[model samples]
Target chain A: MGLPKKGPTLLKKKKMEDDEEEIADLSPEVSDSEPESEPELESESELEDEDLKLAEPSKNAIYNTDGIIDKLGDISFPDNVGWIHRLSVDIDQEQEVDVNDDLARELAFYNQALEGTRKAFEKLQAMGLPFLRPSDYYAEMVKTDSHMEKVKGRLLAEKRRIEEAEERKKTREAKKLAKEVQAQKAKERAKQKKEGIESVKKWRKQRQQSGFAKDDDGGKEMDFSFEDGKAFERSGKKRPGVMPGDRSGGKMRQGGGKGKSQKKREFRNSKFGFGGRKGLKKQSTAEATNDFRDFKKGNVSGNKKRKR
Target chain B: MGKKRKHSETVASAPAKKDAPERPQRTILGWKDKNNTNNNEAQVTESTVGFKNKEKDNKVESKESKGATLNELVELKSCSSCLFFECRKQKDLYLWMAKCPNGPSVKFLVNAVHTMEELKLTGNHLQGSRPILTFSSNFDKNAHWKLLKEMITQIFGVPKEHRKSKPYHDHVFVFSIVDDHIWFRNYQISVPHNESIKIARGGLENSTLIEVGPRFCLNPIKIFGGSFGGPTLYENPFYISPNQIRAIEKKKKAGKYAKKVKAKTRRKVHELSNPLEPDEFADMWKE
Candidate 1:
């Protein structure tokens, strides 16, 4: 056992000297470029985070091609070793992947694995080997039962979280749709009211042309209530007992007080104290000040500038 | 019953031994600091969990005063290949893979380690089933990459018909080189199967892969021509030591206040050299 080991070590020692000489020849060429490379690496240091690499390959780095090939020859298994024994498959990567991009890098790795496995499975199938475990085959697993349980629980939680997010998104969309529908219904109602008014106007014109009734006819007067299209609007004239800002349509005045004295008091209150702010009534509004019909021209100091 | 079980066990193992290729025994030895027991132990155990039958782990103390060096100890054990994990500074885990009794060994700085105990990776397979190794084509692009690939294949691949290995192949090992680092991932191949030994029809199309845990990326630092100590064959010119990186970061931070002070003085000097002239209407608004 010792003798076999000694023989290889002796041969390797002899090869090392020749490899060193080749490195020596390469060292001078490497040294000339070494100073130029250091500054370049310094500039790249800030660009890289956890895993730092030089901007470019250093020219002086040792590469013993023959020695490495010899070592490979020495260490690799003999040619008779079958593919089944190795079970290694090499897959081609189509493009260069940027290391900083986590998603693309991981995708490349995943694709490599997937493609390799496909090729490997085909080879296994051709050889008639047992690739898949039977359904009933029970054995020890790499992870424990307790561990698998945890993994299952985590997967279920992730699925539930995603489902909840989807539900929230769906409800938000539904609310938006409902609001749009409500707005559409209100617009339809407005259109219907406009159409009803237009049709009534048309009918009234037709009736007048056909000589349905005279203007003084009491039975036809009820149909004339909305003839002007101002049937729902309050009249502009002020009533004797009603306040200016009464929202109750003067019903309060009609409902209150039955005696003559109470009616007088109510009328007095309506004129002076019942409703409306006195301060605003005393101030001159824009319309009131602009009304020249209320001014007496003779009483005005017309020649004050000339007199001074 | 015990005697009958033992006889059957031997009978089951006998044919497997005959069918397996002649391979030298592989050993896993690690010397870890006392403070790093938990992480290193979990790493070693999880690594052995895949090929537990073929691998025997020995916990050597960090003290190296013993008569035999690592290579000598491995040679004495008659192991052809050895994986030695050396933990330094209670944090950095350096993995040394050496072919014993001769030359050619690789030292890698292991980073981004996640053990099998993590719950996120849900895949599981038979404990001792042989795993199919798959390598990215870029591994053959360089001489060093090629050598490392062979080393990884030999060390990680379970010998066919290993006594402790199960007959079925239910998992795959992915070794892909990205950014000059070897990334390792183990995935369980779950194919819908029938009662027969073969997969169901269209099972391959429907098959999916789930990741098992114990993921690590290896950055090769040096390749020695000898087992443990030898003339260096290849050196990565782009490789920067972690210590140097840390020191550079510290220097950058230390320059912050000094840089501010220097800038302030320079600005003051610039103002004095280019003093402004008084305006003619400076007192025009004064009474």
Candidate 2:
């Protein structure tokens, strides 16, 4: 049982047989100046991941290249065998792939499969072999009909989820645009009212300069306070800090940030008043009960008390 | 979920093969697990058998990790090759691929197993079609890899004219080596074909593949010269057993309390050795 010493390993070691027996107590220090030594050194220095290889190939690890090649020769088919029998294709990997990156690794495998299939198909075509299954061909499939149905259901569910999300996004955008439009309309209304008030004032000044022409109603000028901005200003007495057209008045409807219909309903309710019991407010308070001035004044006369 | 019905149906289909032994009879063996409620082992074995079309099953229960007994079983069956799935502690799955009589077997730690029953892998193909074997270019870079590739081609590739095999090719198998682990993938090739005899002119170009999966990644641990035990051809230098990894993790978690206690004691000792100086400001504040 003699092994051939043909490679560069022969220059480094005296006998191949001795190298096999010297498997015990072997370390990285034993193998020096080989092509793989530098990389192994780096691995030794770095912290290894769970799946990553050791910093260096173990010194005792056997190569047995000759034995492997011999076995390969013994087991492999004769050269004369047709490609149809083996039905295998080897495709070149373009670059080194990072295993940790799942997408990239899967993509690399997919590319290899795709390329190999393409090549195999071309060869099959050249050989005039019927490789592709026809559309009508039906037989027992690897997966059951029920299993495929489940797969279809899952795919449809995912699509539905995405579509629902898109619909929500579209509605949100439309709502935002509608709000901007409403604000613009309100601003334009205010501007138009201001212009109308200015035009009336100018007309009155011109009439005064022309020497007032008396009308039948004692030459009185019509007051324009209501037409001016003064009429739109919020009254301080009724509800302090309330905007004129704000039906909620920034209090009752605190966080009901709803659409235009909500505001309309609120305004209608404020104008007509909400329908409920008004009897709770009729009861007198303790302060009213203890008031002596109103009691004495009320006792003086019924007409005077009613007037007060 | 019709799981029981599906199992019975698959079992009924198993005995459908009655063909001449033109191809090498590759046998699969596994230990029986009584507590396995999901019957995960049975499903995995059956699905693999179903995928390959006609694989003979010979259940052998052995605790030894060596392939010596497996080699004997292979020779007894007159099988040329074998795939022995050895499940340990009902957790780890170690796959052994061996040439029957003479030598060269590989031990792989199987991870990321997704069986065909999983609904995510949607594609389906003819049950008995011979898959086209495709290998990445790196398989030829080393001597051990080349040998493993030969074994895989023989074991996984259904014979040319086996009676159980379908007439047309409609699926492919991918054996790729990434990060020193061989990953296996199966895909169904779908082409838009209208004719019975011929594919449309650009059908090959238009054809797309859908994954018909039982995805697995195999990390090779050792290559033995004989079928199960012999002179070591190669050993993965970086390979660490899952048990060791688990033990390391447990130790790390277990050490946390001890570490906290040790730090407390050390702080106390330091405080005793060097007491804080009594400052004049203490008297001023007290007064």
Candidate 3:
């Protein structure tokens, strides 16, 4: 105080003190950094009790956690044999907590069913109903969406294949019905065609019988007749080219083509009673239909010949 | 016609069951063992032990399946005594009763038919002091603890509230094996204040434990090799009934009394013949 304190001002002295403090704080940070980096140099033998204790509260939970996390899942339950055994196995297997609630619930139900079934079987044994055995739950399970669904899937696939085959068979039956309908239609069409052809032959024969013999020759364009005398004899009859008696004999009255030796066609020899010339030429067993044309049909007022 | 057929079937089945054993041999039980405990040699054949040991080996050979695992069989075989065995097959409603030759006069009938709902197989947990069935190495190795408990509860169910009026009417049976004999005990698991244990309500240790027994001894009538039902291997002849024991005791008492009366009358006659002769020398009844 007698020397510097008396001469120096108070504010200047305070400033000088603050500068010294700042330098003191800054110098050690730089100097001690190297030693601090060598953390391994903190020898165990030299370790003090103060260093051992947790000195930093900020580092307690966030930076240096002592694993309070597992306690979050803690569920307190009585230590019974069943639960203890279950937990022991679970712990041994080290399974993670299941998030799928449905699976866990189903498994619980399965365990219960299994337990009850086993108990019932045991009871039956005790009751001396020894022949009885527990039914196979696994077999039943395979038919459902259980662990054995793979078997069910294969069985379903086989069932589907059988169903598809049955469907194909149904379609084939429908096709067969359609083919039968087509065959019936063809039979009706052939019958109609035969009736039309018969009418044309009858019209030609009528023209010859109605004293239009020369015109009949023009219609056929050929004369294979050998019995010129019979043709002249037929000239007086109302039906000139046909005789009443010959109608029942030959299916057709062979007015022309006499002695030409045309092969005889027997209608009875045909399988379907058709396909022979003799079949179409049968004399009217029952009269032809009312739609028959008159003998004068298509014979112009006076017969006119076709241009050569 | 159906009734007649059913009756005929029953009659047919009864004889079939009776004839089913390897041989017509009944089980015999004895309180005392005939074999010397320290024979320290090869086993004494069952015949020497007074068992109808015929076809034992043959029956063992005849069993189709290999039989239960040795561990499972051990517990069953070690049950040396059984008070009775009643069988009620699945088809039959009524049970067939076969009381053990040496069994308690009183018994609780164990009926089996129950529904899934009545079984209450779920939501059950170990509570209070449950009956513990202690079996020897036989049960230890082969025992599945959970399965065993479920089976026990089903076989020995606790009576309902109304039926609890009589204590002995229902019981939980604990089966244990000691020295190759199955020691069966019946206990009622209830609060200690309910009487029986006689612990004075005093000792803290004794009051908490709820076990009570070694009450009944069921000498093994027969030890079949299989669980549920199996082929009989041995038939012992020593099983004595309680009535027989009582009758034998009465006969011995009557014989002793008759002898005493005859001795008294003979002594009176002997005294007239030779008054100086000692009582030990008195044999006038012989004359």
Candidate 4:
């Protein structure tokens, strides 16, 4: 019955062997010499590098035409094609990857596609079907691939240039408009001066006709004895005429004869009452004249006598 | 230290202990008697019969002195009767509240009222009292004079022709209605050429002195005879008639009167006329 006092030790040995087998299956490649390096550790490090590469698609190999086609399918175009075209036009023509050639090909293809799409859209519209989705249209027109980066850069620069040119044009227009306004004002001032000179000449003529010397100082006193004698001869009484030291008329002419003329017109109109009604002007003028005569004679006795 | 602390405590409590009064007080007997007498007098004065009798007598005396019967007095209401009457009453006094169309609201105490002629006759009566018709508060004395002149023109219905007089001394006028008697006074405001009695005498002679007081108050039957205790109407002094304006313009033209020049240097001769354009003259006349 005691046939095997070794049964207990054998059982313990078998359990240990099973545990070794399970460990080998779980981590088969791990060697005792590198016990700290697990399979999970190796794969995790490899995944980190992959993640880094995936982070920036434009900077990595995935931004290429093949990568873009693999990720987003065909029809990936750059949105800045116009700028790309302009840059190509400026660059050396001998270059193999001529941006202008690419742009022309792209533009022709886009035009054709746009025409076909528009026709299809019209047909769909007639059938009452939704035609183009804005997102899809932009996706087709914009290239997200790294191969189209130069085209996008060119487009952005051209946009800025166009805006700057527009601003310069607006500035030039403003300056031109301001110059025109200044010239107009200068012309008006010259006209006003001419008118003033003409009025002064007419005033001088009038003064000369009234028996005053043309070259005499307007403010100077003149010897009226001679003129008084002639006036007295004409009508036993002193005649009313332009007197020396009278600068009011001259000032009016220099400033603007229009004011005086306007005043005279207003006075005449008021006297005759001709503005609205008929015959009123004549009647009023006559009455005013009579009243004026009476006032002169009355003043000689009324106010002057009292003062004496 | 213990002794000092004890002393401080005593000092703090001393006032309270000292406030105990010697005895309680009672009202004096004279006080009661004085109060009783005052009450009796008040009661006696409060009797309706006695009060009515005294009030009637006072009213009768006031009416006779004012030359107004009780019924006539009642009929002569306050300025509330006039369409232009705009005033407020405080207690027994009626203040002249000016609702000026061209000025800020002004409240003035009704100082006095004088007839136009009376104001012109009594020159010294308004000396102590500020001139009632003066616009000098808002404007200058010259402006006041112009306003007074306008008022006179409007009241007399006279044309602006008489404005040519250079020495317009007797132009300032005011009117007052006090009791039964209406007194006429004339005041002459003149800018003296020289401080001489002869000049003063001449100014007085040439000045207009109208006596408009006695004529109205003397005859009670007349509308203005009885004292009408209300606002007085004044003629606008600045108002000028068309004929007068025309006359002024004619004189201005014929005389060739130069405008008053504002120069530091004095001119040898002075022209006494206004020099305005024909149109300007017309404009002034039209106004």
Candidate 5:
């Protein structure tokens, strides 16, 4: 009856042991310095302080001991612990203003909130009232479209222009290169001629031997010098070919018998027998000179008679 | 549930789009021949923007003069068809095309010939026909613009010795990129030379020359570098071919059918409610 219950006491001891481990884990300095005893000849009682300063093994041994030493370890938070450890649970607060207190004002908080809310709602309504009409939208779209087209057109024009410029530069560079090549060739030719080298001579001879100078009909020989390429030359004059009257000189069928003059000749021959051309021009001075003319007249009359 | 919600949203959006008017599109524009040779001779501002505005104003006035009808004689207005310079595609996505009004088309023989190319390029051909130089953008780089200017100078720039009191003597070209398309314009520098007042380079003295060109624009789709006619390199999808122009014309014609649509006429009568009068009060006493 004089001592506490066994379970609660054991529980308190276990809790103390746990707390000891926890405290040691949290801060080893607190537990480790306890044993050092470097205080000013220590202020607290030596017995309790010595118990705290003991090493883990010694402390466990003391815990196993059955007496006042075992009871030396006290729990930090016991189940039946009183609030005596804390100074106070709550502050001594005083009311600053009464709940029923009222003050005279033009508008209350609720009324002011409602008025502000109504004003905001009215503003929103006013803002929302002016909606987009179909016509306005269409006009905007058209305007935007026109602007974009202008931009696109401008861009396209610019791109084309740039590309064209680059091409022109390339052509210019090519021309410069060609001029250099030509100048170098001329220089080399002049040097070889001075040295009496046969290469240029041989090349010229070879070109002559290819029947270029005398035979001007060879189309390839016209550009043999490559000198004309330096400047633009007008295309050769394209003279019109001889007319039909001029082509009648050839005796044999006039080059493809399907010509108009040939066709007329055949028609006259069929009508006036063998001397068709002579008969038309000579005007038939002697009317009955040939039996063919009479036969032709008879043939025409006979055919007409048969049809009638 | 998610699928159903998405399907419903799509359906709702489809109807809304159908109800809204369609956007305009861009189409081929006919090259307008400016005959205001006198006004073009007037001294223009040094800035390009001002020059362009002056040119546009002239075109607008010309359009207004021609498009006026009996009913529309009160005020001059620019029709949608006549406003060809404005971009239609960027805003409403409607494509319109006008056939080139010129009859004789100048066709270029696009063959690869080193000698011919050199002759055409190097030879200072002073023939009156305005030369058209087309190049593909696939090979275009930073040097392209400078090259174009050089070519224009080589082809059309008048010599310093030949400078007279004429309005225009030296012509140059400026090339720039707009979107993926390319545009080029020809401009001539004029020097007013008076015999009485002599200056450097003939009688050319205190006078400014305006830029003038019968502008021509063409879109190139491909480029070739071979000696006789080579192969193509990069191809972009932004090319709108001449065939597309024809197709657009056909579709526009089909869509522009004139139906004799009879609009419903309505007539409202006040038979449902009688009109009140002072005589009714007098009649009420008798009743």
Candidate 6:
């Protein structure tokens, strides 16, 4: 190609072509070949710009770290498998310390702190807090370890309280069950006592019904003694203590003997020639009156038959 | 003793005639004392005697006052003016009897009457028993078409222009003599199964005596004024087929012969088949 000699325009066109070539060669390796002093100068200005941006956010964010941590601790980890895996990945990426031993140790510490924080956060959430971000969480964690310690303490206290309540409930149920068993035993004892009384009365009645007079007297005596014996048995006392004739002047006195004056008095009361003879006088008088009426009627009828 | 007391109390409360002379007094009293103490037994005896007496009276009166039987009355009244009066006894009660000089007497019952006067017009006698008048091939052949047309026009009150343009033809006309009363099976020309249109038209053209097949026939005793226990006007099963009759007869004979051959083959095949046991066949067929 031949060069046209219009100097200023030609020089302008030549500079444009050279600038295009410089732009085309703007790769990182090519940039490295440039003077070290120039890059250092450019990087200083870029760093200044980045620092200015960082400082503005850090000033505002650093102050809100406690609040953010409190809020983040409130975020619940879902029990689902997918959510747990996602949470693990998220924590791993954010922490950025990747040596196995170091990661494991950090994970343990973080989990402990996270658990404490989560409990505190849940408490706070239950008290009604708003939405929080992950960055806010880490900032709060960095700001204070005391918050996590407080949460741990509260959890321990709650666990003890729940155990105590459960123990109390169990004891109360045991006592109520024992009372019911005792009442049932008492009812069974009462029923057995009633059955004993019925059998005694039946034995006494059968003894009196047959036509043996001497046997009847003996049976009444036996029945009185038997009833006393049963009463003693039911009371769990010795049988000899309940003898019917043990007391004097009682219905059946012991030894079959009476003092002279007592005998005379007994004789006067026995006018019908039987023991307790006075008790039958009224019954005998009624029978005598009935016999007299029948005799009078027979006499009149016999007189009329003689006349006929 | 308790039962005897109850019996005595019941007898004392019951109405009784002690001195009635119809029976031996001692025996009657003994019988009454034994059984009729209860009111229920007395009432049952009285009712039974009354019922028997009433039944005897009815029988005697029925014998004394003999009148025409219901069937006879129906026959007499229907046969009075009918052209087919000679066949009146064979016809069912209350059926309109039409006679053709050359053919069998056709008895059709009219269950209801629909007239031009009732419809408030003139020029028709749609006053037939059936809502839709089903004509036998004979009636369709012998009936005065002009008279039928006039009857339809007068009864239906169809306008002159509509009647003139839409003339009555071979197709059966089903009328709703009472509003929405008439029900017809395959009434339209577009019915897929009706082969009768061609048969009906042929009958109309031929002027020969035509008999309605059983499928086209209605119960004359049911539709017309027939008494209970009277004869039923049964439709003839045999229809006149004109040129097709011989063909139909041939087809029927062929069908009978085919059925006989099929039965014979079935019997021979059954006999020829092996009477092998089930278990033996099972092992023989197993892979």
- DockQ, all models: 0.29, 0.32, 0.01, 0.00, 0.00, 0.00
Give the per-residue lDDT of model 4 (tens digit) for B1-287.
Answer: 01011111111112222323321110000001111222222211121111111111111233133322322422332111110111122111111111111111111221122222221222211111111121111111232222222222122211111121111112222221211111112222322334334432222222222221111111011111012322222222212222333354465555443444433123433333444446745667665
Clashing pairs in 1: B104-B225
TM-score of each: 0.70, 0.72, 0.20, 0.16, 0.19, 0.16
Per-residue lDDT of A139-216 in model 5, one digit per residue for the tens?
211113444455457657767999999999999999999999999999976664454434446556767897566466
The segments of candidate 1 whose C-alpha lies over 4 angstroms from its true place after superposition are A1-50, A202-308, B1-41, B48-50, B54-59, B63-68, B72-77, B193-203
What is the Cα-based TM-score of model 3? 0.20
Deviation from native of the Cα of residue B158 in model 5, angstroms: 8.6
Q: Find the candidate with the highest TM-score and give its number.
A: 2
Q: What's the lDDT for all of these models?
A: 0.67, 0.67, 0.29, 0.27, 0.28, 0.28
**Could you list the iRMS of every candidate?**
11.6, 11.5, 34.4, 58.7, 47.1, 56.1
Q: What TM-score does the predicted chain A of each candidate obtain versus native chain A? A: 0.52, 0.55, 0.23, 0.27, 0.20, 0.26
Candidate 2 wrongly placed segments (more than 4 Å): A1-52, A204-308, B1-44, B64-68, B193-201, B285-287
Cα deviation in Å at residue B70, candidate 5?
Answer: 53
Alpha-carbon deviation at A211 in model 6, angstroms: 4.8
Those runs of model 3 whose alpha carbons end farther than 4 Å from true positions after fitting are A1-308, B1-132, B136-173, B178-181, B186-207, B212-215, B224-231, B236-238, B272-287
What does candidate 6's lDDT look like per residue over B129-164, in tens digits?
Answer: 011122112222212222222222222222111211
Candidate that beats the other on TM-score, 3 or 4, i.e. the better one? 3
Weakest ten-residue segment in model 6 chain A by summed lDDT: A48-57
Q: Give one digit per residue, the lDDT tens place, for model 4 in A1-308.
A: 10101111111123333333333432354434233644443432222110011111122211122321221211112343221111100111121121113244223222232232333323434545332221212221111234245434554676789899999999999999999999999997677667656665766666778778644675344444333453233333442442344447355434455778778877887886554555564476755866754445445566776788
Question: How big is the RMSD of model 2?
Answer: 13.1
lDDT of 5 at A161: 100
lDDT of 3 by residue, A112-183 (tens): 322332333244335443211112212111012342244345546767998999999999999999999999
Give model 1's TM-score for chain A to 2 decimal places: 0.52
Order of quality (TM-score): 2, 1, 3, 5, 4, 6
* Ten contiguous residues with the weakest lDDT in model 1 chain B: B1-10
True contacts kept of each: 0.58, 0.60, 0.00, 0.00, 0.00, 0.00
Candidate 1 structure quality by residue, lDDT tens digits, A186-264: 9976776686677678777877886876655654643543556654456667777778788786877666546787878
